[model samples]
Target: MLSFVVRRVVAAFGTLLLSSVLVFLAVQSLPGDVATQVLGKDATPTAVAALRDKLHLDQPAWERYLEWVKGALHGDFGTSLVNAKPVGGEVGQYLGNSALIAVVTVLFAVTGSLVLGIIAGLYRDRWPDHLISTVSLIGMSVPEFVVATVLVLLFSIAVPVLPAVVLYGPDASVGQLLPAVWLPAASLAIVMAAYIVRMARTSVIDVMAGEYVTTARLKGLSTWRVVTRHALPGALLPTLHVIALNVAWLVGGVAVVENVFNYPGIGKLMLSSVQNRDLPVIQAIALISAVVYVCCNLAADLGAMALNPKLRTRGGRTR
Candidate 1:
């Protein structure tokens, strides 16, 4: 188990390094000059050139990349091209905001999906199963923007209960964030729930059909007992993997939802960076998201191994 974990961590680090390089290259290729963005449209050629030189934009790409890489190794992501603020500090702040929203969404989505999927699977081909399947399909079919808009219209405009847009202050508390957080979180949750529900339902159905499960039922165990004791444990393993992937996906997927609700998150920061051609901020955010994704997947793999004894062995196979 230790060796497996070590190998996974090592591979995740390698993937993060490669992704950082790709993110840097991709951000570097984006159109527009950061110097021009910094100076403004009316800035003279000489002024822009001098500003570029000051920002070291005049250096070769490889040289700049190496410097940035070196700084990153020391926990510095370099300074933002537009604001001259530390990228690491800025990203850290935004990451917290993004993580809060994503975590809330995941908790709600995962819990609801698990219950719904289990009930649906247990009552397969029945009304409960049909209802869950239909709802999940509808949830999956809608885009986040549409869902966000509907939520805002229903809850904000018509009901006047929650705020439509997220407002962030210097010292925003959880109470202050709730109105802003709920809509985007709900928007993300609705979509994410669909995936979790489907995976959970399938896993439950597969587990319930196993010989061991049949034997347990033949022993005259109560329905709930059979599910909770004999079936749920194994059924949950596949859902754990799906949940991990969704958590990673939330890092990127929240961008559109954030935009819809005017939320202040890494997603919004990345969008603004693109609009302003802020290469440093863009690259930093992309790399951070990549790291989050890689780490989440690593955690998922580890969790699966921990839950299933067969997966812990060196020669055993795991689905």
Candidate 2:
């Protein structure tokens, strides 16, 4: 188990290193000049050259990458060329707001998915199963933006219950944030739940058909106990992997949902930076997203190993 965890951590670090290289190269390849975006297009070549020199855009690619990596190791992501602000400080604020929304969405999604999935699996081929299946399909079919738009129209425009745009102040309380957060969170939750429900339902149904489940049932265990204890534990392992992937998506890929609701988040910030050709902010957010993805995947693998000891190995191979 110790060796397994060590291997996974090392691999995760390697993945992050590779991801940073790729993200840097990809961002550098984007059309348009950073200096031009920072200063207007009307700015003369001399002014653009001076700005590029100041921001180190004049440096060689290899030299700049090395400097950036060195600074990143020291928690210095460099200053934003456009805003002239510390990249770390600005990204930190955006990350906090994004995390708040993502966490709430995940909580709602996982809980709802688990319940709906278990019910659908237990009542396989019944109306309950059919209903859940249909809902899951619909959830998967609709795009998040459409869902966000409809939500705004129904709740914000028609009913006027929830706030249309998310504009949370620094001093805002949880209750104050909820109305602003609901539409975005719900948009994410609905889409995420589709995958979870399908995975959970399939896992539970398969587990119920296993010989161990039959033995438990034959031993006079009650229905709920047999399902909850004997089945749910095994069923949840696969569901957990799906949940981890969705968590990663929530972190980095909620751009459309966030934009639709005008929610201040890392995704929206990254998009804005892309448009403004702000390399520091864009690179910082990309690196953060990659790190989050690698870390979440590592956590998922660890959780799976803990839940199923049979997957652990004394040697290089699982027993």
Candidate 3:
């Protein structure tokens, strides 16, 4: 287990490094110049040159990338062009907010998916299965932004049950935060639950078809016992992969949803940075997001291996 974990950790670090290179290259290759965006259109050529020199943009691309990589390793993500504040500091605040929402969304999604999926699988070909499948399909079909808009229209505009925007305004309290955050969280949860439900349902069905499940049933185990005890554990291994992928997607892919709802998250922050051509902020957020994705995938792989004796034995044989 220790060797497995170490290998996964090393792989995750390599993934993060490669992601940083890709993000840096992509940001550098963007059409507009960061210096131009930092300075207004009215700025003279000499002024733009000065700004570029100051930002080290006048240097070769490889040199700039090396400096940025060094700074990033030292936890210095550079200063934001727009705000002149440390990019890491600004990203940290938004990351905290985004992490909270992501955690809550994942919790709701996993729980809801597991419950619905178990029922659907246990009653395969029955009404419960049909209903769950239909609901999951609908949830997956509709985009999160559309869901956020509908939620805002129904809950905020019409009924006034929750606030349309989630960012805490001046003088906002904990009481005020709940109603504000509820819609965005719900929007994310709804989209995530769809994937989870489908994955869980498929896993459960596959597990149920295995000989061990039949043996458990033949041993006179109760239906629930056979499903939950014998099947659920095996079923969960596959579901872990889906959950990990969704968690990573939620980390960065929440941009549209965050923008629609005006929620302050890492995704929305990245969007704003891109619009303004804020390279430091954009690169920092991208690197952080990539780290999150790689780590989540590693965790999922480890979890799946841990839960399956067959996988553990296979690893041992390979070793």
- Give the top-scoring candidate (TM-score): 2
Candidate 2, 73-168: lDDT as tens digits: 888999987778899988888788777888889899999999999999999999999999999999989988888999999999999998899776
Tell me the alpha-carbon RMSD of every candidate: 2.0, 1.8, 2.1
Estimate the lDDT of model 3: 0.84
- TM-score: model 2 vs. ground truth: 0.95
In model 1, where do residues sit more than 4 Å from their true spots?
169-171, 315-319
Candidate with the greatest lDDT versus the true structure: 2
lDDT of each: 0.86, 0.87, 0.84
The digit string of per-residue lDDT tens for model 1 on 12-97 reads 98998888788878877767887787779999999999978876877898898888888888879878877789988888787788
Q: Rank the candidates by TM-score, best first.
A: 2, 3, 1
Q: List, in order, the clash count of every candidate structure.
A: 0, 0, 0
Q: Model 3 clash pairs?
A: none
Per-residue error at 116 for model 3, in Å?
Answer: 0.7
Candidate 2 Cα outliers beyond 4 Å, as residue runs = 168-176
lDDT at residue 293 of model 3 (Cα atoms): 89
Q: List runs of model 3 lying over 4 Å from the truth.
A: 167-176, 314-319
**Against the true structure, candidate 2 has what lDDT?**
0.87
